[model samples]
Target: MLEIKAVTKKFGNDIAVDHLNMVLEPGRVMGLIGQNGAGKTTTFRMILDFIQPTSGSILWNNQPIDLKAKQRIGFLPEERGLYQKITVEEQILYFAELHGMRRSDARQALMEWMKRLDVVGKVTDKVQKLSKGNAQKVQLIASVIFQPEFVILDEPFSGLDPVNMSIMMSEIQRLRDQGAMIIFSSHDMNNVSHISDDLTMLKKGKTVLQGGLKEIRERYGRTKLYIESPLTMSQLRSIPGVTQVTAQENGLLVELADENVGKVIFEKATANGYIPAFSQQPPTLDDIFRMEVAADV
Candidate 1:
């Protein structure tokens, strides 16, 4: 339960976040997306009170976020900060204690996280000695081991391979199921789409789009479909109402100006005796994001 109302941040002459408003409900994940230097990190800092906003306000559970609020918030910054020489268990325990967890409880949490991440043997190893993926896993554990009520993860999937990414995603989903308010920021649109119930797209320090994922995609209009059939891309492109057709490994991707146009093409294909294997959908979050970002430029 986090709310930001008309929040703006200024760095001298530049406005990093301009009247940005967002809401993250309990038990839901919000994906905050933008290009590099699009004010994503600055917005996170303002929310965390690491940097005060120039205008407007940020509230956690309807109250202003103060030091007490900070205690209930967990942050994993884009630039991972951990002592290179510190052992994995030591670093996690230190952070857990910072959040007021008892040493014994912290130790137990550390072991549980290590096993979940499949790095139990690395508990005594120095962070610098761990591989990049392993170090990233350690950073993630440090942020959430204390079980804060609110979690802000910026690029949490940055360096991990697919398997490790799945592990981290499962953990984040578990936290959300337990009713933690989670806000995630990343360049990986697919992962964001998978985990987030809602999404906000930022460009030039302002929100360009914000809504539930499916609603946003439908709002953008259905412009493309993937169809597997006996027809070639050339034949599909020749059909009325079909603007473009490109071949894929298994089928053809057809782009139309409207949903009705796609329906017309399907009807035509049926009449031509071309029964399709399947039809692909249109306008994913990644598609909506690309369209919005490109329009801003």
Candidate 2:
């Protein structure tokens, strides 16, 4: 649904996105992640045509992104855009109209979104009167009220409590199920891992890692293993294949030399009368990001 080919963008002498290439498939969520000032937002701007790239091209379904393509795109920028004094219903309807929806359709979409987000009781209330979480929900609804085919969400979970985060995640998943190609950008690795089918990790405007979550995790080798059993840390370390063992809040995080070693350690744990609660630890996106980016640095 989205393709970026060797796209490069510059601000005078400094490069923002350096020969970055990525693709997003339909009915999938791709998490675009990086450290601060890593060119994630700039890449989004280039894709939306808010800023032209210094070189390279961004394509949506084979053609360059243009006004017609923008109509099918919904963007919720890092800086949330909403009229503080406007009622939730009014603001959403206004955005819907901007997206070419008729007044009646806009109103209907606003009401349905309000109900879905559990903010129907505050539909008539001004955005400023709502809690931060509720206000964020309104901002999200505004972005997708037109049901755009592609949605770009930057830091959508910022400032949201766990409950609200969970609600927004469900809504995003629903959109994906409906075949909306979704690209989410966030620093939160846990959130990215939970929702993303594929992930791209950027560092200083460069692509450090990008692939299906499970595939990337496996590629990084066996970094840690979760173990819940009667075995002591000392006993685990004495095992031949075990390289490092650290206790987690719930269980042990055992590191191995390789996948083969991880298997050997697991067998040793079982042989030692240690009944594991769960015994697999694939490298997380955060783990891979740190390893790859730091190594490159």
Candidate 3:
């Protein structure tokens, strides 16, 4: 288990991270999300001991994490960290060796990881020769080459297409199933929603929301209605208790001031005689994100 107990980081008079507390156990995935300057990277740095925290403590298994424990952690920063001139196999082996693996074992692990991660091209090919997506895959392979017990991935899906995203997600799940504690940051709310067991949302270095995704949504309540029909946005907004209506592909996402207003919209939809679909559910993560961070804009 990893515990971040009231951890805070400061630069002179400016505070980058403010009293953030979190507990992550093995086999759990925690998603850290916020705007660009929300201190996600700073928190990761503190966890990795790249920079010391100005206050509080970071512990692994109830003890302060040290050099020996650092070997078990894997980090994939938001920026690409690779030698463009090196071959993909060499890069993976280099990272594995840094974690104390023997050359022969590292080479064997590289071959197996390449096959499992579905990395393209030959092992001898230079990192500079691969496409953007393939290069990202190689970087991901390096992060997990030694099978670290704790993994931190920042924007791991940056250059991935839908199919590649699916592949990366599968690999991350595999790591979690092996009892690794994973913490990742992503601007992609949909991907975060699908992957994270729980979420810790930050804004201006402060934790704005933190909890299991389902519980958070349930607590936020069912205030949004999804309707796929001929009814236009204007018509939906004109209904009593309906406060906002946003048009979406094949539907209008209608926001209600009162939950009971959903029934009114349902009746109106029935009268129009073209009800393809109707669902009243809690707001999505995307919706909650915008709502929580709207003041920052």
Q: In model 3, where do residues sit more than 4 Å from their true spots? A: 228-235, 246-251, 267-275
RMSD (CA, angstroms), candidate 2: 2.0
lDDT of each: 0.85, 0.85, 0.89
Clashes of 1: 0
The TM-score values for the models, in the order shown, are: 0.95, 0.92, 0.91
Q: Candidate 2's residue-wise lDDT over 1-297, tens digit each?
A: 789999999999998889999999889999999998889999999999999999998999999988888988989999887898888888788888777778898888888888878873478898889887788888888899999999999888888899889997998899999999999899888999999999888888888888999898888776678888777899889887787889998778888777677666666667866484756666777777777767864
Model 1 Cα lDDT, one tens digit per residue, 48-96: 8889999999988899998877878889989888899989888889988
Displacement of residue 78 (Cα, Å) in model 2 is: 0.4
The candidate 3 region of ten consecutive residues with least summed lDDT is: 267-276
RMSD of 3: 2.3
State model 1's lDDT: 0.85
- Tens-place lDDT per residue, model 3, 1-297, is 999999999999988999999999999999999989999999999998899999999999998888888888988988887899999888888888888778899898888877876778888999999987788888888888888999999888887888789988988889999999899998999999998998999898899999999998877778988899778888887788888888877888888878888887888789957688898999899989999999652
